[model samples]
Target: MHRIAVLLVEPVVGFDATIAPTLFGAAADADGTPLYEVVTCGLSRAAVTTTNGFALLPAAGPEALATADTVVVPGTRYAPARSDGVLQPELAAALAAIRPGTRIVSICTGAFVLAAAGLLDGRPATTHWRFADDLRALHPEVRLDENVLFVDDGDVLTSAGLAAGIDLCLHIIRSDHGAAVANEVARYCVVPPWREGGQAQFIERHMPADPHASTAATRQWALDHLDEPLSIEQLAGHANMSERTFCRRFREETGQSPGGWVRSRRVERARELLETHDLPVDEVARRAGLGSGGNLRHHLRRGLGMSPSSYRKVFQGS
Candidate 1:
């Protein structure tokens, strides 16, 4: 059995701890042989409280991590560790005890925990999009990528907030085993087998109560015409605003520009088409509105660091 350890901290987020077991635990070979043994541990044996209402009775302490092939850090409650970037003594010590060469994975603000322990320093990683600026300010040495759903920097991996954890977990399964097994796991978990890490993290903020107080309509229209050739001016015309005002409002409402949003949608469409169909690369490019396969390759390479064919072969299966 591959021993996987989940390190639960004080006020841990339930979703984070649940990720490993729900995905990797549920994973099985074609004959239903479980591929991984998951263990949840904390600083001590006491019941660990979660950000949610409940607490959990952990089966072990830091010792559970002693022989783990992988150690996972779930997101914790908002504290100085989250904002000011302080580390509790116990958490730091627990992290220090991790076996050498063991894979370390973080979910959402769990990146804060790894950063607090100095593990993320001088490494490329990411966390919840909302916290990217704060993480960057405190940990200047770390290479922060705000756009990715997760980052696989060899021994360490970090994922964006909430559901992106699923993407990272599925990615790990694919890397450790292969796409075929990972696809089975995804089917078991009701998730896509492969999600490009470069896929934009959906970081929408709550809009005002007044229906009139949103740019949602314009964004909706943009989505409807994602495959259409669009320019900033055309989007501005739809919003009934000048270029400068539209640009400002667009950024505030959507957290991205018209062009950036369109490009992201194109990439997402290409990824889906690549995985679900056997269309020629050129047709995939045409449907995704990337003009041609060469153009699609350029954008995919820029965002995902892989050629379209290479990406499809890796994730779409034989």
Candidate 2:
């Protein structure tokens, strides 16, 4: 079994700390056996208080990091990394216990810790949108993209606030095992099986001036007809609005233009088909509304950095 060490520092985000165990612990094998051994460790073998006014008595100490295959650092207000852009001596020492090449993850402001440790320098990363400016201001060496839900920088991963942590954890499971296993875990946890890391972190969702007017119906219609040729004009007509009005409302609700949103959804649908079905590339592309196998190949490569066959091989063990 893979060993996952959740390292908790003082004043940690209570919700962030629970995500690893909740999802990873729920992962099971074909026969329903656990696949990961998750343990919570503190800077020392002591009780750690959280920002929620509760305390956690960790099951292990920093020594656990020495043998962990993956180490997760949840957001914490107590880490000096959040402010002065450096890890506290104790925290630094505990992190140093982790063996080389151990996969590292950060949830929300937890990116600060990784950034302070120099683990994120010269790497693409992200944090809670609210703190993106501060993180960049403090650690310019870290290439931070605040728009996405998470950043999977090979061995080092960082996510936006709260729910995005769950997304990252599920993504890790998918990468380590397969989409089927990750989807099962997600079902058990009552969360969506997949939300691409490229999805926007923030969407301006103010109510339209006319309360009854919305692009929701049109968006749903587009999803149902992904295999059909969808254009902004058609979508605008369905929404009973001018093209300009539909475009503005779509961005407000979904944080993306119509063309971009359609392409992303098509790519996502293609990914699902690739992972869960055995259709030929041409057929998959047709079903995903990408016109042809070559189009599918181009979209998949551009969006996910992998070809259809490569993606299928990774997910379904084809």
Which candidate number maximizes lDDT? Answer: 2
lDDT string for model 2 (67-168, tens) is 999999998886478889988788898888889999999999999999998999999999999999999999999999999999998899999999999999
User: Candidate 2 regions off by >4 Å?
Assistant: 206-211
Residue 313 of model 2 has an lDDT of 92
Q: Identify the candidate with maximal TM-score.
A: 2
List TM-score per model, in order.
Answer: 0.69, 0.91
Report clashes for each candidate as comma-separated counts: 0, 0
State the RMSD for candidate 2. Answer: 2.2
CA shift of 139, model 1, Å: 5.8
Q: Tens digits of per-residue lDDT for model 1 on 204-300?
A: 5446456564667877787677667778888888877788877776666656776776787777678777876888989998888788999999988
RMSD of 1: 5.3
Native-vs-model 1 lDDT?
0.82
Q: Where does candidate 1 stray beyond 4 Å?
A: 1-4, 14-39, 51-53, 59-70, 77-102, 126-140, 143-155, 159-205, 208-213, 239-241
